[model samples]
Target chain A: MCFRDAAVRLRAQTIWSGVSLEVAPGEFVAVVGPNGAGKSTLIKAILGVHALSHGEASVLGLPPGQAGRRIGYLPQRRSFDASLRVRGVDIVRLGLDGNRWGTPLPVADRFRGSRRRDRERVAEVLELVGATSYATRPIGQTSGGEQQRLLIAQALVHDPELLLLDEPLDSLDLPNQAAIAAVISGICRDRGITVLIVAHDVNPILSYLDRVVYLARGRALSGPPSEVITSETLSQLYGTPIEVLHTSDGGLVVVGHPEAPAHHSDRHTGRTHERP
Target chain B: MIPSAGATGLSWNVADDVRQLFAQHFMVNALAAGTIVAILAGSVGWFMVLRRQSFAGHTLAVISFPGAAGATLLGVSATAGYFAASIAGALVIAAVPGTGRGRGYTNQSAVIGTAQAFALACGVLFVSLYGGFLDSLNGYLFGTFLGVSDRQVLTLLAVAVVVLATLALVGRMLLFATVDTDVAATRGVPTRLLSIVFLVLLGCAAAEVSQITGALLVFALLVMPAATAQQLTARPAVSLGLSVVLALVIVWLGLGVAYFSVYPVGFYVTTFGFAGYVLAASGRALITWAGTRRRATPAVTR
Candidate 1:
C-alpha cells in the first residue's frame, strides 16, 4: 500500500495534506495521534470511501477500492445492540461471501463442497481469533473483547493481502487490548498479511508494531515507534510543547501542554474527539 | 353481492368449519392473496426490522393509501397506483443522503415523517373528492376479503414472484450491508446501491400488504411476524422461516375468524399478530428470568 503526496479535504477544510506513506507486505503498522488528527479519514481515503483532494493512493498494486476483494477492513468500534440476535459465526461467514449475489445453497445441492469450504474457512478464522467457543452465541451477548475477536475473524475469514482496521482496540480493557494486539501481530507475521491499524493509545501494541504513523495538526510523520514517538518529534508534530514520557517498564506516555486547552483536554478525557 | 350461503356460521366441528371456510370462490381468492402477501411481507419485513427501517416501511404503507385512493379517483387500478406511488416514495426517501446514522438519520426521519403526513392528507382529499360509497372507502382503508378477486390474486402472485426472486438474489449481500455496512462497503458490497434496492423492495412489500391488511394496519402483516420471530430465535434462517410461518398462521386465522364475525379482517389480523408478538416477547422474558435465577442460585450456594 502506498500514498504519494495524498491530501483529503472534507467540507472545504483540509483534513491532512501532502501525506506520503507506504507499507510493505506483512508489515504491522499503527496509525496513531491525538484528537482531530484525521486518523480514520486516512483509512477511509485508502479504502476509497473518501476521495483524496490531491495526489494519488494505491493498494495491493491497484487504485483505492479497485482491490477491495483483496482487502479486509474492520471499521471503528461499534457496539451491537443488546437485542440484536445475529450470531458471531454468521457475522464471520458474512465476511467470506457476503458480497455474493445469491444466498448460499442448501447442503443437498451440487455446491455442497463449496458450502463446506465456506463453513470451514469461517470456523478456521474463528479459531484463529480464539472466538470459536462463543461464536455460536448472539454477538450482542458477548463481551467487548469477544466481539472484537469475532469482527477480526470476519475480516480475516477471506484471506486478504492487506487488512485495514480502524480502532480495533478502542473500548477494550487493558488485558484484552494486549491480547488482541498479539493476535493481530501474529496474523501479520504468520499469514504475511499487511495491517494498518488506527489507534488512539499506542501502549498496548507498542512492542508488536513494526512502524508508527503519527498524525497531528493535519500533518503526519512515519518511522519506528522509538524514533517517531519521542518528545521532540511529537512536540514538533503538535506544534506545541507536548511531552512523551518513558516509564520504567518501557512504555511511552504522551502528555500535552496543560495550558493549551484545545489539545490538553483530549489527553485525559478518554473520550474520542472525532473529526467533524 | 352473493346471497348468504350454507355453513357461513362457525360450528363446533373443526374439519367442517375449515371445509366451509374454503368452499367459496371469494374465500379461495382471499386465501391465495393473503398467503402471497404474508410470504412477501414476512421475508421483506425481516430485513426491514433488521435494518431498523420500520419507520420507512410504515411511511411507504401510508403512501400506498394515497396512491390507491388517487388511482381510484383517476379511474386507474388501485394496484398500479400502489406500486407507482410506493416506488416513487422509496426513491424520494433514498435520495436523502446518509445511511440511517447520526445527523443524517434525523433529517431522514423528518423527511419520512413529512412524506407520511402529506400522504395521509392526500388520501383524505382524494377520498373526499371522489365521494365514493362508504363501503368502498371502508374496504380500501380496513381491507376486505370479499372484494379480493381472481385477477387480484394472480396480480399478487405475479408481484410476489418478482419481489421474492429479487430478494433471493440480493438477500445475502443485503444482510451483510444491513448488519455491518462500513466493512461491507470496504469489502465491495455496494452498500449505497443495496440500500436503495432494499427500500424499493420494501415499498413493494408494504404496498402488497396494504391490499390485504389495509393501509391503516399494514404493520399487522409486515412487522409483527418478523418482530415476534426474532424474539424466539437468534439464528437468521430459523428466525426468517419462523417469521413466514407466523405470518401465514396470522393471515389464515384472521381470515377464518373474520368470515364468521362482524369485525373487519384487518382487526382480526392485527389482533392475532399482536398476540403472537406478545407471546414471543413474554416467552423470551420468562426464559431469561429463569436462567438468571438458576445461575444466581448456583452462585449463592457456592
Candidate 2:
C-alpha cells in the first residue's frame, strides 16, 4: 500500500493534506491519533471509500476501493443488529462470496467441490481465531471480544494480501485487547498479509507493531514506537506541550493535549486535514 | 338448526363454506393475488425488519394511497399509479445524504416522516377531487378482496417473480450490508447500490401488498410476520422461511373469514398478524425468563 502526497477535503475544508506513507507486505502498522485525527480517513482513502483531494494512493496495485476482494477490512467496532441471525462461521462464508451476484440456488452448488472447500476454509479461519466453540452461535449473542474475533475471521477468510482494521480494540478490556492484537499479529506472521490498524490507544499493539503512524493536528510521523512515541515527537505534532509518561508496566500515556472536538470532520465527510 | 337464526337464514358448514369461498372466479383471483402478495411482502419485509427500516417501509406503503387516487383522477390504472408513486417515494427516501452511520438514522427518519405527512395530505386532496371514484378510493385505503380481477393476479405474479428473483440475486450481499455495512462496503460489496435496489424492491412489495391489505394496513402483512419469525429463531434461513409461511397462513385465513362474513379481509389479516406477533413476543420472553431462572437456581444450589 502506498500514498504519495495524498490530501482529502470535504465541503471545501481540508481535513488532511500532503500525507505520504508506504507499507510493505507483511508489515503491521498502527495508525494512532487524537479524536479529530484523520486515521479513519486514511483507511477510507486506501479502501477507495473516500476520494483523495490530491496526491496518489494504491492498494495492491489498484486505486482504493478498486482493490476489491484483494483487501480485507474490519471497520470500526459496531454491533450487528440483534435480530441478525447469522452465525460466526456464516459471516466468514460471506467474506468468501458476499460480493458475488447470483441466485442463491442451493441445488446448483450442492455437487460443487468449491463449496466444500469454502466451508473448510471458513472452519480453518474460525479455529485460527480461537472461536470454533462459538462458530455456530448467533453473532449478536456473543461477547464483544468474541464478535471481534469473528469479524477478524471474516476478513481473513478470503486470504487477502492487505488487511485494514479500524479500531478493532476499542471498548475491549485490557486482556481482550491483548488477545485480539496477538491473534491479528499471529495471522499477519503466518499468512504474510500486510496490516494497517487504526487505534485510539497504542499500548495494546505496541509489542506487535513494526511501525506507528502517529496523527495529530493534521500531521503524521511514522516510525518505530521507540522513535515516534516520545514526548517531543507528539508534542511537536499536536502543537501543544503534550507529555508522554512511561508507566511502570512499560506502557506510555499521552497527557496535557487538548480535547478533540466532538464532531470529527473526517469521520463525517471522509475528508483529510493538513497542518497549517 | 333452531329457529333462532330463521330470520337471518344463515348456517355454518365448515367444509361447504370453504368450498364456496374458492368457487367464484373473482374469489380465486383474490386468493391467488393475496398469496403472491403475502410471499413477496414476507421475503422483502424480513430484510426491512432486520435493517430497522420498517418506518421507511411504512412510508412507502402509505405513499401508494395518493398514487392510487391520483391514477383514478387521471383515468389510469391504479396499479400503475401505485408502482410509480411508491418507487418514486423509495428514491426520494434513498436520496437523503447519510452524513455518517450514527447520524444517518435521525436524518433518514426525519426525511421519511416528512414525506409520509405530505403523502397523506395529497391522498386526501386527490380523493376529494376524484369523488366519482370514492368507492375505489375506499377500496384502496381499506382493501377489497372481491374486486381482484384475473389481470391483477397476473400482474402481481409478474411483480412477485421479479422482486423475488432480484432479492435472491442480492440477498446474501444485502444481509451482509444490512448487518455490517461498514465492513461490507470496504470489502467491495457496493453497499450504496444494494441499499437503493433493496428499497426499490421494497416499494414494489408494498405496492403489491396494498392492493389486498390497503395502504394503511400494509404493515400488518409486511412487518408482523417477519417480526414474529425473528422472535422465534436466530437463524436467518429459518426466520425468512417462517416469515413467508406465517404470512401465507394469515392471508389464507383472512380471505376465508372475509368471504364468510361481512367485514373486509384487511381487518382479519391485520388482526391475525398482530396476534401472531404478540404470541411470538410473549413466548420469547417466557423462554428467556425461564432460562435465566434455571441458571440462577444452579448458582444458588452451588
Instruction: Provide all candidates' interface root-mean-square deviations.
Output: 1.5, 2.2
- Show the lowest summed lDDT stretch of 10 residues, model 1 chain A: A267-276
lDDT of each residue in B1-302, candidate 1, tens digit only: 12243345888699998899789888888889999999999999998998889989999988998999999999999999888989999988988877433112357888789879999899888988999757556766777656787878888899899999999899889888888887777777788888888889989998899888777788898899999998998778778888899999999998888777766778888999999999999998999999989989978998
For residue A97, model 1's alpha carbon misses the true position, in angstroms, by: 0.8
Poorest 10 consecutive residues by lDDT, candidate 2 chain A: A267-276
What do the candidate models score in CA lDDT, each in turn? 0.85, 0.82
lDDT at residue B68 of model 1 (Cα atoms): 93
What does candidate 1 score on TM?
A: 0.93
> What is the CAPRI rating of model 2's predicted complex?
acceptable
Identify the runs in model 2 with alpha carbons over 4 angstroms from their true place.
Answer: A16-18, A53-55, A83-86, A103-111, A235-243, A255-276, B1-18, B99-103, B132-134
- Best prediction by TM-score: 1
Q: Where does candidate 1 chain B have its weakest 10-residue lDDT segment?
A: B98-107
- Please write out the lDDT profile of model 2 over residues B42-141, one tens digit for every residue: 9999999988889888999899999988998899998899999999998887787771242234567887788899998899899889885567667878
For model 1 the local lDDT of residue B182 reads 72
* The candidate that achieves the highest DockQ relative to the unseen native structure: 1
Model 2 / residue B233 / CA error / Å: 2.0
- Docking class for model 1 is medium
